[model samples]
Target: MRSATESQKDSAVLAELIRTLESWKETVVIAPDTPDADALASMFSLAKAFGDGDGRSAKVSLPENSLSQRLAFLHEWANLPVATAEDFARADGFVVVDTAKKSRCNLREDVPEDWDRGRTILNIDHHASNTRFGTVNWVVGEASSSAELVYRLLQAWGWPIDPLYASLLYAGIHTDTSGFSLPNTSKSAVAAAAELVERGADVVELGERLCRSQRLSEFKLLRTIYANTQLAADGRIAYSTADYQEIADAGCSAADVDDQVSVPRSLHGTRLAMLFTEGVRGKTRINFRGDSGVPALPLAKAFGGGGHDAAAGAIIAGPVPEVVAQVLPEAESYLNRLAQKP
Candidate 1:
């Protein structure tokens, strides 16, 4: 639960986002570098909201074409095209969704420097670690996902909400909350979901697409993790790593390896799970998943990354072995502290 003061601050920030959106034209919406369902849905919704106006269009920017096929439904629902260099240059402003830090946008490498120079930047996210890096930051960590916040924003602005948009919002809330199984799944999340359903979000189809649908390569990656997971902290922590060769051997793409965090996390006794994957050259992406008593943020931040308590991630510049060697002890240490908390 947020304190009264923090709640008030969130309200003010949200109000500011509404005011800014009113004047925004030719805006660009950027999700995280490696966006999950939540980030993708949030980006698509914002683009839809802004792009529907007369003489207005919004560009959706991503690090690359890294989204899974499961999210292909979103591409069909809305023209969520990836922004190009020309689109970025033509954009007058930016709206960043589902990401906390300005640095995490990877915008520095993907776009021109002046993109951040004097343009209006709007930051909308639900992570507590957000730096309020935009001219107007509407971050509310109490929300289930950034999609829920976007839903609220549209309602506040009296923007149109169709079934296509509702499903996009529902997809974000569903995946980020792990189908409302995680502790971050709040009463508001439930209420918002109900509203989206009423607005025509197909709950059954969305659930199947988000959860049950998996590619062959994803299953192969899961099988590999099952065969190689290592335990520490007396079984409280379980971790696994997949190097480039192993990942390719499993016939998985970088996006396919992203969901492997769930494999170690599903262990019966594991309280914290980590998956270190070597995707990009010279960089290891570490994904964290924690149980009720184990929080992932501290460990993620210790490595210069940030996310929610139960699920977080970081990208370290090193080989897979060296990155895993450095991160495992930290996970064990954090679990030990949790064990001693009583």
Candidate 2:
């Protein structure tokens, strides 16, 4: 864990980021990767801050078709523009929030090379695996969510946050921290939530909407996956999968199954859990979750993807059976290593 001084240094970077945005005279584009609730909320908040300051014209863009229906209620979702890397090239400045790496941003392939080299690029995120790819990086791994970081950014800039912005930001923080139940929850997280609530964030209503609200189809899919879960020989490893046909039968989208992947991983006796799902174009996405002291990023990197120590993911080019056959052995070996450790 970083000391309080280290954390304050990370927080101070947000002030520098605000100074950079304040000096910009040309068009600025705010983009977030994959359009998840956290990404959209953070981007929208930052865009509002930029627009409110210095008469600067700011636009919000995302990779096409990335916004999920579940998060359509965000205020900016309706009017937010969709732009590719080409549009980004012409912008005076770029703000990349929620995602820190180009691979995760899903930027268009046709964009010009070196498009962002001369432009000021500010990277803001809460992911521990962030690659620090921006000219000005405000990566705060200790924050509960990117929304929390965005909230601080708004405060530093003295931007007014109304109820809508508060709700959106609260949703991002709520969802990412699993309602403050995840291991990363912190004192600053609670303080941020309190401030947002005072500014008209409906904690109870938002909690119900995010946690209690779920489609019936998602429930059916979760049932199938839970029923098929398997525990390893030592009972410290668990694995589950949902093939294409099963997904179709449940009538649920990939996002619905995304949240369930971590359930098996959280079992009391399990040191690690894996969930495999069939992805677009015959690729299978494997999500890895592990307890403390277990490294999941290296394991995920072996399969061409990367994430944090406790949670990671990978996409493999193969059928579910082949992926499971390859992945299970690695997970087992990892468990054995843990057992062999002093």
Candidate 3:
């Protein structure tokens, strides 16, 4: 982890990035990882900052089906150019936001093996496990969300916060912090939220749109997961699984089911919750959530996945039943250790 002083130094890097961006004569392409609201919002916001200037046009690129219905507003939501990697290649420079690792960008297959290295690549993210793989990396793991960093950067650059940019950034911070219920949330995050609201973010509307709004398919998927939820001894650990067939029957996409897996974790007595979903590529996606300080990331990493302490995931090759059978015991053991904490 970077010290407070080191983090301050990292914040300084954002100014350097602005200077570099100002000096650039070519078009800038802002790309974000797939299937994430925070990433999408950050990409669009940053693109707006760069494109609003003279001799500079910015485009936002993302993989297909990366944005969910809730985030689909961002598509028709803005006038910014949204395109794929092919369209991005036409730009002179690249600005990658919200994603620290190249693998997470879902661009690995699309990006050319030998792309131009001299083209300036600015990487900004808030993930603790960031790879820092960019010509210019501005990673602040402590920033509540990448959107928060974008808001700060915009402020530093003296960019005005329009309603569209403000709303998108608010959604990003809201989702990433779980509505400010997460552990790492800070005063800056709240202040950013307040400023966004003042800039016409429409908090009530966004809340209703994101949280209260749910498709029928999503409800059906949640119903299935609720039916299968099982609690371990003393209800300390909860486990649930949804097979591919069940998911298909619910008429829900992977993204819809993605969040339902965490339902088991909401059990009042549960210290840990595990959800296993069968993926199409002969893999089972496991999501872990816990209230205790068990640090699920290390365990997720053991299975070739990683995330924060309270939330983490892994993908294992096998049938859903087999995967569940393999992981449940491990999850139980983890809860046991957490319970034994002095």
Which prediction has the highest lDDT against the true structure? 1
Tell me the TM-score of each prediction against the true structure.
0.93, 0.87, 0.89
lDDT of 1 by residue, 1-342 (tens): 678998788777778887777776788898877678888899999899988877888878765556665676776777766777778877778899988888777453557766766778899999988988988888887789999999988887788899999999999998888888889899889999999999999889987887788777777777888888988878888888888877788777676655678878888998999998887767899999989878899899999989888888899999998998899887887888877887
Ranking by TM-score: 1, 3, 2
Pitting candidate 1 against candidate 3, the one with the higher TM-score is 1
Task: List, residue by residue over 103-144, the lDDT tens digit for candidate 2.
Answer: 566455565667676878889887677889888998886677
Model 3 TM-score on a 0 to 1 scale: 0.89
Candidate-wise lDDT, in order? 0.83, 0.74, 0.75
Superposed by TM-score, candidate 2 places the C-alpha of residue 46 at a distance from the truth, in angstroms, of 1.5
Clashes of 3: 0
Candidate 1 local distance difference test against the native? 0.83
Candidate order by lDDT, decreasing, is 1, 3, 2
What digit string (tens of lDDT, one per residue) describes model 3 on residues 1-342?
457898688667977888888876555444444356677778888887888889787766655665566667766676677555555566677777877566565453576644435777788888666778878888877788889988888988899998888998998899888888877567889889999999999788889877888777677778889999998767877888888888778886555545565588777877778898873546788888767576777678768776667677877999898888888777777667766889
Candidate 2 ranges with C-alpha deviation above 4 Å: 1-4, 25-35, 75-79, 84-86, 108-117, 255-257
- Lowest-sum lDDT 10-residue window in model 1: 106-115
